[model samples]
Target: MTTHFWLNETRPARQAGAPENRVYVRQYGNGRAILLAVHGFGRSGARMERLGLQLGDQFTTLAPDLPYHGKTEWYDDRYTPREFSRILQQLLDRYPDRPVFLMGHSLGGRYLSSCLAGLEHPDLRDLVLVAPDGAGGRYTNWIDTLPSMLVRPLARISERPRSILRLSGWLSKRGIINRYSAEYLKSNLNDRPFRRRIAGTLRSVLKFPPRAEAFERALQRHAMVCTVFVGDRDPLLHHDRLQSIYGPLPSVALHHYSGSHWLPERLLGEYYRNSLLTTVP
Candidate 1:
């Protein structure tokens, strides 16, 4: 593995969930506050390393791969946004005193949305959600592609019917439905190996439909300093609803960029675009 591919531990030391699981982490900076970087569907922890590294100069960064993503082990359990939120709450509990700042991209952004909607963590200070899902219920509503329509029903079936989950996995791996599903996120992930890891994880998230009621409860409970950023041209989210969601955040801010949903990767390393990531008021 390359230096970037290998995980680095500095603060609490690194740990993995299981033997087959790949939960590599890289930490940066001297600040006491923690920014938990979460990547979108199909993406691993490594993709957010640059953001961690960039923001680490000012704050302590903890970026980890979600289960069944990146280097993590795959399981039969339905990994919804609520479950991911619980995992994050646990992370906050593990680290005390330091204010937790959550940053997520794409599906990771969607998880942040659910967390923000339902989070009750008193320690959570702020949230930076990039291209978040469920804002206008974009990911839930998007049907431009046939895969989007098929994936939701497939996810719903995976819960009770054991045989379907297997079939879902089979179709996902065979490249019939998988390639079509990833057309939107290809630009952000340049590496072929990285792309496969991301695509596979996304397949898992797609199979498990989000629980809207639970997500709304979480939204009402948590009130943190939040900011939602979206690409102006991104077709997934409805612009009108995005505007509606922006009006009520008590401690929240909204930012619009010229890029697509994969703004982080597309804008990474470029000084101008990088500036925008930190250009919040």
Candidate 2:
């Protein structure tokens, strides 16, 4: 049987009260270890599927669509912490004995950090962050850290064309958001439906600030093997920012690529080592 393929699925919530917990995942491969891959902002699970495809020989990748971006249904007033935990549990529960690895890209890094903050699975062995967020990057701004009551109104700023354009422009000018993010916002807010979708993603982003200290502490507690892959020219993911987040732990490897925000997939393949994996944690 060919284990190297892709599968798209939307699994329903098992718990009766958790109807909002349905999750959509794009899975690839059937290797011994399981990889839970998270994608960047303004992207679906398909983006992470690209990286997962490269590591499929050694790892089976489970990339889930974050709420507001894909098939996942979420229209809540707030995107609470551990919001996806149940769905994650549902996915990983199938492979009880497999050593699980975590990988996140850009904004997905923050989601990964939030996931690890309370997840207690010992089989989790490694974390691969590619141009990830929550490394003390520019995104942890006051606007995003607002109280829940205030955040809904803040996210609604994206509802109107003028307000969102001005906001993105202001964020770019203040360096609170990346150039790509600013550009994406400017170009995509024309349609009302897309604007609504953008509002929800913005709300989710606002709800989860940088959990760096919490994430780092969790990594130490779990003794997780961590490797951060960054592009040298990626303005959003700088060397100093990453060093600040992972420098205390000498075990963490920081690999810098000679490129831009989009890392070369071939280089990522070069660094994947199954030797680093232990027997189910």
Candidate 3:
């Protein structure tokens, strides 16, 4: 069955000097409960529309295209958690009186984690992370080692030597790297503007990596409920790693599923019903 919802196609004007983020929001229902859904890297809010629709009975879901993806425009070449946090704050301001329950996947989850660590928002009620990236792991450790100052310059350099990106694709074809990894590398290399945006994003994240201790502190400070879902075979993050990183936190609960980086639609629907619905009331 086809569902009807409102789509705001206009690009909203952002403050001067800040990144121009034209948020394309897909709204479902007008329920009393508020929900803000964020999508992963390389994905748009349109991806989260299904999950939002599934939970329409319980919430008014606001899924917006994040900066640099989908219909959103990012005029500033630099992207950092602080800048992204400001964008989030603007979105939150739209619903000043309501507490928002946040659900994010992959990169989206990382953004939420960063916000919880550094920003203070009294209206943020709870959090749900699906295969989140900012949590401690080998990937995060590698990110921690990089110098943020060098990232943008390196991105520029890589653009000139297009061979580097082509070589990455060749390596993927030769089975040196997994197909998923290879495609991701090639996509960035082919798109110069996106590559620069990605560089800025990485630079910001590396400059201010999320601290597990800080996440715990924030959760305690806000008395927020957090639920984490991890796929057992997720190429990006494994369930075991999630356990090691977030297991000790009293406010966070972890659930494992038999899937990969992307959970089955049935499982995702059930998650919304079981986790979000139960938490709201």
Candidate with top lDDT is 2
Tens-digit per-residue lDDT, 24-105, candidate 3: 6667766566777788766877786666667667667877776667777656544666666666666676777776788878
TM-score, every prediction: 0.60, 0.81, 0.78
- Residue 90's lDDT within candidate 1 is 57
Tens digits of lDDT, candidate 2, 190-235: 9765687767766776556665667668888888867888787876
**Best by TM-score, which number?**
2
The TM-score, computed over Cα atoms with residue i paired to residue i, of candidate 1 is: 0.60
TM-score of decoy 3:
0.78
RMSD of each: 8.4, 4.2, 4.6
